[model samples]
Target: MIFVSLYLFMFCKMEENSGHISVADFSKHLFWDVNKSEIDLMRDRHYVVRRVFSCGLMNDWNLICRLYGIQEIGEIAKQIRDLDPKSHAFIALIAKIPEEDFLCYTTKQSTPQHWNF
Candidate 1:
């Protein structure tokens, strides 16, 4: 009886730790937020963020897509639009613009070198 009780306790704890990662609409996961903050600190130090790509497990890619206005079905479309000839030309034009007008995604850190934030 004692052994059975101990096994059950350990099993429950494991499940709790791997609790269902339900994708909340807008509210970020409290635990994930904490982890991100730590990662940001490491990034400031230029330490672990360079060594590790992505640390914590992401809940669901689909949820992020929906929130970002790019649903799963439209993902390919979104990609195509980004790389469209017109968009490419626009980006080229913008690249020629002065630094003050140049607004683009920072490539200083690739996904492999991305911190949680």
Candidate 2:
């Protein structure tokens, strides 16, 4: 009975953590504001903003399309499909951008080891 209870507890803990988006994780990884338009980000030359358009994440692509009033989501999706059909569409697009760009946008105060990646 004790072993069975412990096994169930561990299973539940794993399920809770899987695909869970914690606030700290979201803030640390995604530096861009969802409310900001693509034009505003372009004018500011934000790294994440630029990459989100060119990158493969469907969620980011859709959000940018909606925020910017652009109708290029399908086109972008086609491009991503052509490039890597096996890639995960919903995962965060942080790894798509170059490390240099991340370092440039990330402050030391916010991300102490930003350059390590």
Candidate 3:
């Protein structure tokens, strides 16, 4: 019982520090349609962080609450709101990506059938 409790506590602490989504995980979910090269470029250029921040800020509160939990939403909002001007500007730059782009990235599509000659 003691070991279980300790493990649970550690797990919660780890989750708390990592935020609800890490850059890598957020990238996977956001850019599911993009090839690995694009994903790699986004990661290398810190585009993942920008996208996560933009999604967090622009997405509805209900969605945010669903993803991060009701309790976590407040903390996440506060952290983003508290970001310095320079950091906020950087996030805003990438946040300009169109809603259509997000939709295209997340939408499910059937695989194309190969043609035989």
Worst 10 residues of 3 by lDDT: 96-105
Which candidate order results from sorting by lDDT in descending order? 3, 2, 1
lDDT of 1 by residue, 48-74 (tens): 211111221223322222222222212
Compare the candidates by lDDT and give the number of the best one: 3
RMSD of each: 18.4, 15.0, 15.9
TM-score for all predictions?
Answer: 0.19, 0.24, 0.24
Model 3 TM-score, 2 decimals: 0.24
Q: Over 4 Å off in model 3, which ranges?
A: 1-24, 27-29, 36-38, 41-45, 56-117
Pitting candidate 2 against candidate 3, the one with the higher lDDT is: 3
State the lDDT of candidate 3 residue by residue for 1-117, as single tens digits.
456434533444455433343234443455555654455522333343334444533233223323443234323323342233333333233233323223223442354325412
Q: In model 1, state the lDDT of residue 38.
A: 48
- In angstroms, give how far residue 41 of model 2 lies from its true place: 4.6
Q: Candidate 2, residues 68-96: lDDT per residue as tens digits? A: 32222222333332222122221113223
In angstroms, the error of model 3 at 46 is: 1.7
- Local distance difference test values of all predictions, in order: 0.29, 0.35, 0.37
lDDT of model 2, residue 109 = 40
